[model samples]
Target: MRNWESFLRGLLISLVALVGCWLVAGPTAHAATSAPQTPTSPPTSILGINLTGGFTQQPIDSNVISGHSVTLSAKGTRNILETATNPLGSRKYVWWESTDGGSTYQQVGTNSTTYTFTAPEVTKDTPLMFQCEYDFTGLGLFYNEWSRIATVTVTPDRVPTTDIQVSADSNTLYNGESTTVHATLTPDNATDPVTWTSSNPSLASVDAYGNVTAANTSSTMDGTANDHGTVTITGTSNGRSDSTKITVGALQNVTVNEGSDATFTLNNLPDGMTVANWYKVDDGTTTALNSTASSYTVSKTTVGGDNGTAYYATLNYTVNGSTKTVNTNAALLTVNKSGLLSLTAVPNFNFGSTDVASVSQDNTTLENLDEATSGSNYDGNDNGELSVMDSRETGGDWTLTASLSPFALSDGDTGQLSAVILDLYDPTARLDENIPATNTATKIYTSSDYDGQTFDVTDSQLSFAADPKITAGDYQSTVTWTLSVAPS
Candidate 1:
């Protein structure tokens, strides 16, 4: 009996300890599995913006002029976590303009990279400023800083309103000459077209474009006399008119000796005559010469052609409230030739430095100073003759040869250039005669038959051809010319 009681007491103590432990662990596990987890914050967002592209604050003077249109552009860029992304879908742009410095602003444009606006006209100089604002609407709506200010100036259009004046490019003109007249309006924006008129259409005529042409006249032929007349030109604009007078005068006569310098003078010129001009006329072709004074000296070349070559002089002067361009009579030039054959030296030809794979040519002309005669007419049998003999006394019909020597350029390198050739043209044959690369004296020119009379001949055009492969340094060659009797 004593052993059974001891066993029951031990079993009871063990059951109580097991029950306590089970109760504590069940509640702790339940609390852990059923409780709500701590809520996490949403992913942070990083937004960035900028104003770029063609945005600049330039000087007012450098901008477009008034009454003109200008375009302003702005570029917007966005990034997420410092990485570039498209901002077009989430952003908008607004452009503003300020005409009064920065005191006030007006919305000029929006939602575009470019805005075209016409500059307003002003009485005085004005400044215009433009800026752009970017609006961000993604995630949350926000605004970006204003873009750089672009400034320009609008200059006033000063149209002529009063004291309208008219002027002319030239106040005087000779017969068959023209002058241009222009009107000055008070304001630059004046739209009135100027009407032009001539006091005497028989003396001078005015065109719609303000061009005035002097009429033809038959005047005196004395060496110092001129036919003088006046014509008034009027320019009318906005019911206002201005008039200018133009004077016309006759030409005088002059005489000169052949192969001698001749002086042409306009004596008894009208008062206020300050400018003088001289011209040479040959075969209906006119050539202007440098002669500012009342007198001009004719050169030997000018008096070397035919015996009856003529020249004229024009005097610019103001007379009786009018400006006039009066012409002098035809100045007859007499050329006296001793019937001798003469030649003028030709200038040296320089091809200049060239690179490889290129071709170069030099054109030179030879002049014949002999006078033209019946026998030696331009197209006659005894026209003219030219012959070349080798300097080394090479006999017979000689030929011209070319030899290119090796040269050193500025780089201190030496090389030989080749394929050099010479070309001569025959006026009678109307063909080109090319000289071969051989050392022979060539007769470049020879008449078909020789006549006793020597006449002025046309120029001979000589050309030298050089191959690009020739060394770059300065290369020189010698050509010898000798005059010989014509071959029978």
Candidate 2:
């Protein structure tokens, strides 16, 4: 009987130790093993009392971008029936965050139904963990447990600016004109601020805000070069930049006389162009010219030939790995000249003096009638003694005729001589057309054939037969010449 009594006492002590172990480690934050324990089950029954239920709304897993904030919320409900019967405790809520997959936790928020936190700058390899805990310590029966663990995922979104495009409201500006610059950034969410600059401040100036103003007309900022010069406006951000060209002045039309060279220029042309191309617009037709110069000239212009002509240039450039093209304003050209058709120079023939004539006398050598040739000659020829010019703008017709009178004795000795011929040797030698020359009228040249040019004729002589009963004392003859229109 003594041995049985000692064994029963040892068994009772062992049972008390088993009950103490259950109270040491409470339920998991989620009641990890199963549902909350009841009043009869001491280890999991909300500190052995039932005044409130577990969280009705716990923190849910969420995703957020870097540099942005996210809100977390949780709520617990009271067992009104149980709480009214025993209003013993007020609960306190606390939030916690764990970085190491829930290995340990640190308090981040307390006594709040909601918590807001910012996302990290870079995404983490593993998701972050968060939880909410409730405590009812003031009441005689204390309750302790935590809400289910929630996860937060973060990702980076504020990327650096990769490209920037800049433009101007007015690409072409006059002196004293103002314009604004606009810029666009790639990826839209970039955080870098754009800086503004000007390539040539003398032609144009810009402010930090991208506002631009053109140089004044009278300004000698760059020794009169800025008055009509090109300038570039650029915007840079995050090591990326883009530029736009602004033409300071517009193109102008010019007027010039015909038969002269005319020059057309584009003032204030921007740089970085790829071998500009010039185009001429004539009679409603646009054709490409061989010229590539910004200041181009049309050589030896004709009267009204290029009147009302317009020219323009295509400017191609590169910016930020992109190619772009622009055209300068059209410039017009006008040519003016008057029409004229009048004789310029004429040739006079001189026959060498002879005392007496025998059978036949001929003068072959021809002398031009200039200041030193015996008389004043109005019109002259380049290769000969005869010269004619037609400065008319269009085509015209003209004729030259000649006649001879009989030779007579100079001393009035009642002597006469005949059979004299004045041959105009190779009249077409220097004239425009190959027309035969005779004593009668003949068509020489027309403005259409030799416009804005001269007509010259040479090689004329006199051939005469001596009179048998000749009483020669010095002989003379008269030759008549006439220039008439329409070949009359």
- Against the hidden reference, what TM-scores do the models get? 0.32, 0.27
lDDT of 2: 0.58
Best by lDDT: 2
Cα lDDT tens digits, model 2, 1-488, are: 89999999988888777655643543323322232222111111111122235654546554556777777766655443335543755777777787776767777887888888887777543467887776553323346546768777665654577888888767877555556676677765454567789998876888755767676553111122345557889999889999999877545466776556888776554345543687888777788897777677887555445767876666666544556555555666777764544454555555545444444343222233323233233233334444333345455465555565566665667875556565555444444332122333434444445344333444555555554565645555554455555632
Clashes of each: 23, 7
List model 1 lDDT by residue over 250-358, tens digit each: 3323444333466655554434455467877766667778777776666543232544555667666543345656555555455443332323232233333444444
Each prediction's whole-model lDDT (CA): 0.48, 0.58
RMSD of 1: 32.7
State the TM-score for model 2: 0.27
